[model samples]
Target: MDVEALNALMRSEFSQVANDFIVQSVAPMEAVVRMPVAEEHLRPGGTISGPTMFALADVSMYLVVLAMIGPVTLAVTTNCSIDFMRKPTAGVDLIASARIHKLGRSLAVGDVLIHSEGMDAPVARASLTYAIPPRST
Candidate 1:
């Protein structure tokens, strides 16, 4: 779908707080989400935390699926597995590149690779499955 429609749907379905969690660089098949490193997102080693990365992965997958299927607010995550690979740089933005691996009638699967801004390797990787709502006649 178009950017305007996608932005409209995001504003309607998700709260402004959630919307502020990540910016939508693109919709559906691919998206780039940014998460700013902040005190609340830091861990013991002064590195960005895991939960913050997980949130990025989750929202990235949601946007990819929604891009393919339109704004399905009922679409819910059925499964998710994330692997944290490296410590993220402090005071940097994290970018998640998410794409759909499969899109079926009842489910959608997505893979995400997250990296710290300017980092060469991924800091984390995630695979997610979402249950898509049935289409109305």
Candidate 2:
């Protein structure tokens, strides 16, 4: 799927928080998702919350899988390991760049680097494994 198709899928399938993210781009084995940081996503320290970034990483990888495999909503995260590296820049959108390390018949593995807009280094990094359900023949 391309950017528009992915964004539309997010809206139709994941409407609860669809407004929070935008699909920026998609290429072979990769995708970029942007989450516009909002007041609700902030913690007491004026920094983006860990859960918020985690969601971004998860969704980013989900989109990458869909971009390559088509709209497989059953493709779900089976494992995730994320490291919070640094404080995210306050009041800026977060960008998640996800690359698929491997894509198999039933699984996809990828990593996401989330950077605060205009920042040099990533604020968080995540490695994820997704289980893609067997397609109906």
**lDDT (C-alpha, whole model) for all candidates:** 0.82, 0.96
lDDT of 1 by residue, 1-137 (tens): 55555566667776654554465577547877777677788888889988889988998788778777877878899999999999899889899998888899999888999999999999999999999989999
Model 1, C-alpha of 25: deviation from truth (Å): 3.1
| Candidate 2 overall lDDT versus native | 0.96
Q: Which window of 10 residues has the lowest lDDT sum in candidate 2?
A: 37-46
Best by lDDT: 2
lDDT of 2 by residue, 1-137 (tens): 99999999999998999999899999999999999999999998889999999999999999999999999999999999999999998799999999999999999999999999999999999999999999999
Q: Which ranges of candidate 2 are over 4 A from the true structure?
A: none
Q: What is the TM-score of candidate 2?
A: 0.98
Give the C-alpha miss distance for residue 69 in model 2, angstroms. 0.4
Q: Model 1, residue 121: displacement in angstroms?
A: 0.5
Scored by Cα lDDT, where does model 1 land? 0.82
